[model samples]
Target chain A: MGGDFGPQVTVPASVQALLQYPELKVILFGDQSAITSQLSLLNQLQHPRLSIVHCEHVIANETRPSQALRSSQGTSMRMALDSVSDGQADACVSAGNTGALMALSRYTLKQLPGVDRPALVTAIPTNTDNKTWLLDLGANVSCDADTLFQFAVMGAVLAEQENSASPRVALLNIGEEEIKGNDLVKRCAEMLANSPDINYIGYLEGNELYSGRADVIVCDGFVGNVSLKTSEGVANLFIDSIKNAISTNPLKRLVAKWLFNDLFISLKQLNPDQYNGASLLGLRGIVVKSHGSADVAAFSNAIGEAVHEVKRQIPTKISDRLEEVLLERHY
Target chain B: MGGDFGPQVTVPASVQALLQYPELKVILFGDQSAITSQLSLLNQLQHPRLSIVHCEHVIANETRPSQALRSSQGTSMRMALDSVSDGQADACVSAGNTGALMALSRYTLKQLPGVDRPALVTAIPTNTDNKTWLLDLGANVSCDADTLFQFAVMGAVLAEQENSASPRVALLNIGEEEIKGNDLVKRCAEMLANSPDINYIGYLEGNELYSGRADVIVCDGFVGNVSLKTSEGVANLFIDSIKNAISTNPLKRLVAKWLFNDLFISLKQLNPDQYNGASLLGLRGIVVKSHGSADVAAFSNAIGEAVHEVKRQIPTKISDRLEEVLLERHY
Candidate 1:
């Protein structure tokens, strides 16, 4: 979560995590004064597990992640990931900058064997009891047949770890037809249909993904990012639209008050914060990327997700499965 | 509006249009029996201005629009555009296939001067008093800087025709900053920022398009399509989530009933049918494309839009402006 706002959000979230789970340990990494000030605001002066790693300077807006990482050896996010890579920290979570996080994690941890491009995987609540996992939401925009196939395998393994025993995978396409969508979707479908490592359920339209037809959906980063943002925009638009409509008229206002709680709960369930962090699948170590705008609740959820990924050893299992599938396909 | 599920949706909508406005005239272009059968289902069938143009066949699903135009001579959609080109009809509306509509219109009507690609412009209802116009939602996915500039001009012209005077146009990008987005958006910003033809207000993020920041929002078909679909998906998800949350408990159910009208009105405002048809901007004649799943309301709206476009002489005005701009740009 290489976040733009930095320690302000992360520090409070760290304290909240400790309050929720007594055993939970959090390390605050950022500008020392900024982290201490945020924690002080929360009345968390000091704790056994909570500690701060001081980094006087910060990455500027114009500095690329590689440039920042190479120049600043002890940046907050970098140090956190380094902890994970060196076995000091089980997993690392950030709600900062996405590109920075991806670059740092990939460079430091290295890509998993047989995985060409790592994908950003996030869960979206669906109509069904089970949540649907969408991948490459903004990781790799352009993907080949092999990259897409590997994404499906990795996504399936991640879903299984999340709870699904045999998660069904579907390629995001314009239409359900085997021949529909751009060249990439078409090629990916052909590969997924033949791949034996994952339970590929065939093609799914953008609309059907939320309709709860499949558990795991995969696409190139360009389409995925657009889809994800589109979803978020629509959700915000609806809520705002409803709120405006309700406040407009007297009769509607009365109705709105009665139905407010129901709507609130329903909207809460769909909140991006509830499904806040995206796992950087195909990385050697567990790296959960939270949204830059994530609040305390969202950050806590992301930290919990990071903890789960480490405890389950999901990366190792996914890598082993990916290698077997790649070898079989190659031979 | 050449749609796969034509005649059934369009015929009723055509009748509804006539019923809504007694002065309106409708000419259905499709299989005669299919049109007649639908008309027979309506109570007031006999009208002096209502007529039909018989076409024997339609473009099949597998046929690309360009391929269909080259091979299928008697397709209904192509024939409808021919009616406009030949002055038999003032404008054409279809709930038929989109690709076929694009291909036939581009071939028959040709492009307005200076317009490289004819964009599909759709209106989305926002919280503000005016509806937001989103262009090239699914017309041309891959476009260059020049094409985007043309799209902005066409979109702005269409918006003005639709009663938006001095319609502000904004290039949709990943971020609002001029430097944000990919190469296409960046170059488009430079062109749009300096272009005398458009009232360019700079870049708008995908999320802020609904905030009423700009009247006309422009993007390539790929991004536009995803944005439109994503908005639809999120809106649907929000409604579903709210409904589920409300019904989960009795207390919430009471609140939901009170807020039902507010929610319904707001959701209805966001409904695609309200802003159903997308004008194929830059075409020689007025051509409106409705969604394939368009019901009676959407089709009727498309017909209404066609009538409005014809009355406003949008195509002619856009062509005149584009010609002027093209000459100035030395294109």
Candidate 2:
């Protein structure tokens, strides 16, 4: 994983991965000694499935992804992506710089057919039986009507695979009303409504998403990023607030104990790390982007998700669906 | 107070005002009987301060404030704002259309000097000891460098008045590094860093807002709106998740009871309603905009806040500060 604090966290994570999945093979892509030092601390050592691919060069936290990738050929993050592109690995995962990861993947691997831009897609648990999938969480800031429509298509496909059944897609607007958003959302609504490939359920306000309105929500990168981050901040805020309320006064603490189950379920649903990495949709290969602050458990979960995506052949399914949509478009 | 749903929520809220502050005067601007009926339900009969102006007209939800005011004269929200402008009331509060409120307020009340656009400022409770004031939360979608700089100044002033002494203002960027954001954020950073009006603390990444980086966080409307909503969504998600987790198995629920105080405090810290209603800064009068879903408690708290703003003469203070900043700009 491409993280700021490298193998310090990844080493324990790799060991945890082995424990979770017996058949899993983990190839560490960082400084050899750093990886070795971390792995040596683990109780289980010298597992055949665990291997290290050392790329001595490191991408400093301050370095821009584009500049780093252009200047350093041996950066661990770049090498990991290269391994995926060159078929040395089935998929790649990272918890390092998000912008750098996006820039590197877009520049190196390139976009898939009919995919104008690759979006960061994550599954958010909803009140419904199935979770909701949201896209363009932080990949592209500016987007047009057509791009959003494409996001709906991609998000729907991802949701179908992840949550089962045909996922209903909705455009994330300021309001549920078609006429209630800025110019971008209005045009996007029109385009998504016209598109036949998506199971478009029309527009949903930001607040309605948590109310379990739809299975897939699509928006431009700016809005999606804010929504995703806002959700994280609010979740953290809620957890913090609850803790303070219950602990600050003695009486409330007793009440809190009785309502503990109710509160825990609520707080856990909002942790971004629990959901882990978002899938880089509309890419030729299955790539997952984890949060920069992701710990060992989060990274391992991302890897597990990556494995699931690869096994599911999500890319192939998306390609086939896009081709069908394109054929229908010509008609 | 510019919200999607007004009168229905506001009328009841106005009645609840009496309970919170017994000496408060409430002049209902909508149809006299409509508001009276709501007040009557609370068993408040013939209170000297509770009065209503007969106005049958309303600004439609879709109508822009400029258009609504030009075309319609008797809108309840418009009349309420007129009460503030004409000095009929100490402050104006609304849960009606936000765009309409902004448009009407800007047109009727006018902006303070050196203020290009009046921002919607609100205080969200963070994990830190002090609450953070975020401005331009949803006022203007697109803003220039100058506009953003003004927002920072006004946000800081608001933060200070809200009890944050020597408030530190931070420009909201994608990353915390000096060079790590889009062109707009970069330009804003330079302006904020150079500005004498605000206690500029440099940049804050989206994820770090909750981590207590700064007291006042400033951004354009698009980013601010998304961030605010996303925070709300995430809060809800966390509450739901924690509830599910605690109840997932009987054993976890038992443990959850013991940790209830910690959990509840954290969740309460993120309650959006507690921070409901953003002030329209840079305006002639104190205009507070509460959320459409604001409950009786939120409404009561908003009324309390309006009283505080009126007592502090926030508008005059902001005006004086703006003059000081502008004069410094000339020198």
Candidate 3:
């Protein structure tokens, strides 16, 4: 009972995930009636791998994170987190309010031993086949140099998991020069440069973000969030402009039937649905947050991401790596 | 002597502007020989409105802003700005390094009264016919609440000149709420809301940037620069993906010959060239900064923007409006 669509979208997505992964088991936490109605509609009311926990309350998207934290008992988001905390579930996925989810996850799951704060990390589609892992995507609005250094480690760990190698880490700054950004960014850059264990590739400008120059790009949440959202906005504008171009011309419309099908095939790499889930890293338990407005395919992608993290033991890897890095620095 | 193409791009652009505006006089401040060669190629070397001032130095793009200011006496960028300050020219336009240009502009033409620092403001192409004015695009790395509030006023002033109305000014943040954003942003939002002189909208997310929701959007330079560049990156990615799609199908290419022309015709409003110039506002004189990689048409657009600002007396307007608004609040 989260996100804009509530059970209508999540139920089908859960069913899809169950079908995709033979060993996957899903626990749906929401109002039993709403969950059952959708389950019955899809004839999955009694699926063997699927279970339902009747949740009494749901968190509204408008609720303040601070307020949500105090009164989160029995809420679907909290109960789901509790299930993870109690070791019943390997990971939890939600499409609820971002701030509330972050707050609840941080409070309930707690931070890893060497981690200062949990960061929201997501893979952004690049111009090439490879995806760039961008971190601190609205998890913390502002971060100090130490926190940013920690984020770089976490981001590189995630990228290493995906790429199966020493990932190239780059600091997101206004300019590539050593003297370009604010003191906070400069200090963070210095820390990354001094770290021998990390493959720090110096600074990257925002324009080169999708150039596939770095495996992991790190920045504070404010800049990362704005950059991520701004990319989406530009993509939307381009799509709208193209669609308008196709619609306005009658001849183009006739050609678009064949052309658009091929175009979508080529443009599939740039689709947002495939990159739906943004995992909250640095926490003890895995929590993958889906977009609030995710559709069925998008929500299914989030579930897949949680499944991937569970198998990879991402939280454990992050904890071990952070400890190793901190120990190497004699911290 | 500035930008990628230097006189190769600027000379033709100056000739175009002189042709477009008969009253406009252009002083070319660079190597006199290089300026004459380009002017002679265009056969505008002896044009009545065209003149050249030989400059002894050029600032490399890699030069730090601090170092650029120290030796900027006879540099092309500085000379052009000095012309504006000495009343030889009403406005200055450059496609030099952004940091160098900002430092020189601030040093040569002092800030307006009541303005803490100058901000870079530019019009972004929107989904509708109207454009959005975004400010503080890499002028200052970070800004306080008072500086952001002043940016809002300056941005609105520029937007009003374009729209001829009370432009709706919105603060760019991760979310739209009283509680959202960092302390500085929240405090600035309060300032905008409290001021009766500003038509302040609540807040704008990055995804709504091109939706034309607000005429003027304000943010600190760091966030603003990243957002602006991120949008460009996304646009480039989209164009590349579409071009790749078009190239893969030979039959589609034949259809694209006609369809592409029509498509470009419809997509003209979204073109970057028309919106190339980013003005440095809240200064004692008008200074327009062109894209460093700008072509002739794009450079001409920057000159056109400078001409418009000169005619409107944008700096004077900003100073007067800022004083009036500041006086009203007893600041």
Candidate 4:
């Protein structure tokens, strides 16, 4: 059992994923009875492509990483990651605690060679009808310059998989000037600029995030997390403003009811459901973390992302590319 | 002399402020000829309440803080701040380089007693029709726990001047849990919890920023700046999305042209011009930094903010309150 709705949402989402991808096999690592009950409701209890492994413990959303790591022997999150590490599963997806997920994934699956830390990477929608990759989203709260540089390397390798030969890597800073940012960001900039493998852009401020100026934006976990969350907050405020505008008058409300459907269709690119999954990058095994409050459709999107990553062999490519870049730079 | 349009924007803004506030007097520091030319255009060249102090040097926006500090003897930004220090002006407002302004203000006006560093504080509009104060917006990139605690103290004091005796102060972080954030934020949280003067409300994530759950949010300049700019980016993206939606079809364009005015009026609170001023808090004298690209209306708003801070005697109140709190906590 995991996430807010546990098996009720996860089982349905997994069933949807199984229906969508004919060759995809899913292994549910949670309470067998709970999974069976939900699968039974969907008439998928004995689906040929689906299996279940009963987990004795479940990680709470509030559990600290350290606490979860200590008693994570038979937990659902631990067993799922174990399936990937043991070569039984191609990838693992979970709508559970992010901190515990990262901690357990690091402990069970381990980091890729030359990767000091695993960063949480996600695709953020931009105004240019494309997405930019943002990394270190609360994986490591504080990162040294060397750690940040490694994140840029991993981020660039990940972005290159999206069809760009050499992704423009940028350090997320307060200003675009050469003299802006602290010692950590400045040093990281220097490292990225000198690396021949990375197409290092000088700096990108937060306002330029949605301009699609860079393919990969890297920063310490704290700044990345705040920027992502702040975007959500502003989006919510804007949506609320629209709702209030339509509700204040009867005529406007009627007009909105007539035209809102088309408006939403036009703005479909801004949908959060499509961007639900965040991959734990730099790990040896693929682990996709879904939003805790995700619904069936959103969780299904997370499963789709994991399948995509597995098909692309993201982890292997990141490992090989990082090694080549490091060996060349003598880093 | 300073900012993008220099005296062209600031002069007309000064005239506007003189018109709005009959008892107010404005001292403009820039090229005398440029200031007079703009005032002459508005037919206020002989205005008694307005005076101009010509400065030979000007600081470019690209200048670093350290570089600006070295050669800022007779620059427009430095002279404006010096007027406040010498009691020639009650407060100062500039639409110039943020870093240079911060350095020169700290050098001329100096920090209030018990204050380690002055912070850039601004009012962000929330959905509740009230604004929340956010501080350390790119003032100090990397802050220790003690410095962050001082920002909270100064933030609370500033918020109190806005008619709230006990403003709920919150530390901005990635998560709302006690175990979240870096060591600096954690240590600052502990200090805030034990202090009797502050109304500490624990951690606040970025998504909760606009929910009005906290009246004042404190963080290091790096995170605060990123959050603020990210919000602006999101807002711009949403606006662009709406524009794209309306322009995609002829019928929608016609409808938008008819109703967009009313919709914009309803969303007037989201306008950036009204929130153009960001005060440099914890300083002995009031110094409001306007957006560099601000027009006349936006620059006038900055002057209005300075007058409000002067009337409230924010600096003296902040200095006194911080001393009382520090003394009570034996800090």
How accurately is candidate 2 docked according to DockQ? 0.33
Question: lDDT of all predictions, in order shown?
Answer: 0.77, 0.75, 0.88, 0.86
For model 2 chain B, give the 10-residue run with minimal summed lDDT: B173-182
lDDT of 1 by residue, B30-136 (tens): 78887888788875457677988888878765567767778757877788788899998889887766777788898999987777889888988766777778877
Best by TM-score: 3
Considering DockQ, where higher is better, how would the candidates rank from best to worst? Answer: 3, 4, 1, 2
When candidate 1 is compared with the true two-chain complex, its DockQ is 0.38
Q: In candidate 3, which residue pairs get closer than 3 Å at backbone N, Cα or C atoms, i.e. clash? A: none
Considering the true interface contacts (CA pairs under 8 Å between chains A and B), give the fraction that model 4 also has: 0.56
What fraction of the correct interface contacts does each predicted structure contain? 0.40, 0.38, 0.57, 0.56
What DockQ results do all the predictions give, each relative to the true complex?
Answer: 0.38, 0.33, 0.61, 0.60
As for DockQ, the candidate ahead, 2 or 3, is: 3
**Candidate 1 lDDT by residue in tens digits, A149-184:** 888998888788764788899988653121246667
Query: Which residue runs of candidate 2 sit more than 4 Å off their true CA positions?
Result: A1-5, A15-24, A37-46, A176-179, A245-266, A323-331, B1-24, B36-46, B60-67, B176-179, B210-212, B238-269
- Which candidate leads the pack in DockQ? 3
**Each prediction's interface RMSD?**
3.8, 4.6, 2.2, 2.2
In model 1, how many backbone clashes occur? Answer: 21
Task: Tell me the chain A TM-score of model 1.
Answer: 0.93
lDDT comparing candidate 1 with the true structure: 0.77
- From the highest lDDT down, the ranking of the candidates is 3, 4, 1, 2
Q: Over the full model, what C-alpha lDDT does candidate 2 score relative to the true structure?
A: 0.75
Select the stronger candidate by TM-score from 2 and 4. 4
